[model samples]
Target: MATSKLHVAMYPWFAFGHFIPFLHLSNKLAQRGLKVSYLLPKGALPKLQQLNHHPHLVQFFPLVIPHVDGLPPGAETASDVPFPLHDLLISAMDKTKDQVETILGNLKPDIVFFDFGRWIPSLTRRLGSMSIYYSVVNACSMAFSMVPAKGLTLETTLDEQIQPPPGYPSTTVIIKRDEAPHIVLVNDPPRAASFCLRLTAILKESDAIALRTCNEIEGPFCDYIAQQYSKPVLLTGPVLPETSATQLEEKWDKWLNKFEAGSVAYCAFGSQITLQKEQFQEIILGFELSGSPFLVALTPPHGYSTIEEALPEGFKERVGDRGWVHGGWVPQTLILEHPSVGCFVSHCGFGSMWESLVSDCQIVLIPFLPDQVMGARLMVQELKVAIEVERGVDWIIGKESLSKSINLVMDKESELGNSVRNNHVKFKSIFSSKDWQDEKIGTFVQDLQFILESGK
Candidate 1:
């Protein structure tokens, strides 16, 4: 039996990146017999139904999302619009406060898990419930940017940000100079100037804090967050749900099978990281230059409507059947597990970081955001399981640098190549174990029960 019959409410940010992970944890809790009320955009219901493995125990509460000024009509999730319009979507989410409050009042969940809503604590408190600020991002990212002592502001310079947040534990895993722009929130709207400030406020006000990480990979960083925040820092242990039963589509299956085992390099930037036209051309050309069988799945880059329009000159004629460049979503988990896929070039989204960790493919990082950069650092600098693509001063990746990073990892004889391959295998073995993953989820439930029942 579950530790208690506690009802948990989840309200993650509207992004599918956030929605999927939140539901993964919800399924784990539901498996233990706890009930979950997942609050999400109304349009996401159809997509989420396929992922919710426990329909009997988990219930979806599709939110009636309100349209706000500047957001395109029906852009319910982050993937529906360009990255620049994220704040406008956030503004729309905030406008749903009244709708959410009514739902919470009716559902009367014992505990609510939320992120990106600084108002959740107050709203839940008023409803006579406890709140957990469950972060979908990793502890290292939160520690680096969102800690209270960071004093993060729009004026915060790159030099200052590269320095560790006060009492931050990691030395080698800091963001590089070029990647700092993603963190400082320089281009954000006035209301969204610095997410760290808002996140810090939410952490301070929340009854408890939780992250999607385990101490094995980011122990000191998780510890720092718990210590600095002065709250229970609960961990969900890199909760990547199993998608193994989902087979790769036939087109990709046939294409990948033609290559020798571990010869094809697959590159995907998760939902949010769209490269500029110049950068996109450089990356695909870099893949061609590598002379490896390649698959590149990315959204159309900025200022372009389609992948074909953005391809480098003569790109199609030169690398005709050897390269597969997709402009739409492919089954990433299935693609990663394909026998012929040797390397994964990714933006290191927190979810992607965990997925990469548990996969057999060699990892290469091309992070475009702060959280992503932090996740990359753990893999590259600390664990030595991956290498990052070096970017020019403008933070644009060079074709040569991208190809070199892939070739370096794919080269079996090189020292760095051998070391990264060995490390990836070592970590993969640990994370891929079903029992280890289950134990983490079990402990997570026990702790939540303790907090909810005992009111700790």
Candidate 2:
């Protein structure tokens, strides 16, 4: 079959950060008249169905998440559990292999796109389908840590992990601390080891590798990946998000309207990251210290059931009406597009990274995960389009440091801030160009056609 007429099925790790981008790519493919089967848990269906603009071309295939030993009843995705319980959820996903096989056998898609499912390639190959390791993380991160040349293994030390893999393109991204971020948090060597091993294994096994990036920003890194893995690295461009007709919620819109244009700071750390109480409070205090009217959306802090209950003493009274904190979903894209939001304080997750770039906001990054840290560095060092909030002793983010970073970008006249602001404007123009994104998507389809015909 011609690639244009091909059907592609996607199965990402059970995290919004992962699957949401999968859906975005599906939307891109659907626009080109390609059919897509998005396989995800039944719980994620309602939300994703709403986001499915091309219902006829893009269909949702729901799967049952089998109950794991320790997980709370009905816990499905990463959002339903804390970080420590993630491995159990992955186990549950593994148990669904029979279900996945049955679905694919019936659907028989031409190509399968997956991340974190190491068995997917073998399974798809048995079914005579091509499997692409569709990664939503930045290429630099994978190239640095998980590339074949790195020789990383379960026994790799923190010292070795900090070093760049042989022939990695950039020196900007590194594990600056004595311990990896996960070590500081989870401290479970086996889980971390299996994660690294499984990810690299999938890279080695997949028919091709795909990323939601254009060559403009990460070309060299992508090249490094292709060379190291000895596989075709497909670029889907930025897959700039499809515009949503949904308006920003009335409450947030009305509050943001109170601030002047280019005056408010917006802080959010995507879905998966649940910060400690100390860190969460410090971040809120950081915004207060910045003295900029701010809106912060975050998950509930550790040991706290609600964000309001987690606040430091007298916090609401001290900040007065200048600040608001919500522990639920907010329309991030619309908020970024709002004129009042001048600074975007983000975790540098891949999805948020693109959103920040395309929006007219000064970027401030606070990254904890390896991929996020690398992405933050890419923006801060390579692109010079953003600043990272500095971490002090033992990877602790100080409120003053966060305040300083925000103020640096918000202050309009600061030399460093001006440079980043100008750079952001330049890149934003390039990224937001519809013709350019569409062209990459076109090339992407052609590449798929070549792969399907030639079976490389």
**Could you say which candidate leads in lDDT?**
2
Model 1 spans with C-alpha error above 4 angstroms = 1-4, 154-193
User: Candidate 2 lDDT, tens digit per residue, 111-182?
Assistant: 999998889999999999999999888988887777766655555544434534332323322333223422
Model 1 residue 266 lDDT? 96
- After TM-score superposition, the amount by which residue 383's alpha carbon in candidate 2 deviates from its true location, in angstroms, is 0.2
CA lDDT of each candidate? 0.84, 0.86
Writing each residue's lDDT as its tens digit, candidate 1 over 305-379 gives 899999998999999999999999998899889999999999998888888888888899998766787788888
Model 1 TM: 0.92
The local distance difference test score of model 2 is 0.86
Model 1's alpha-carbon lDDT is 0.84
Clashes (candidate 1) = 0
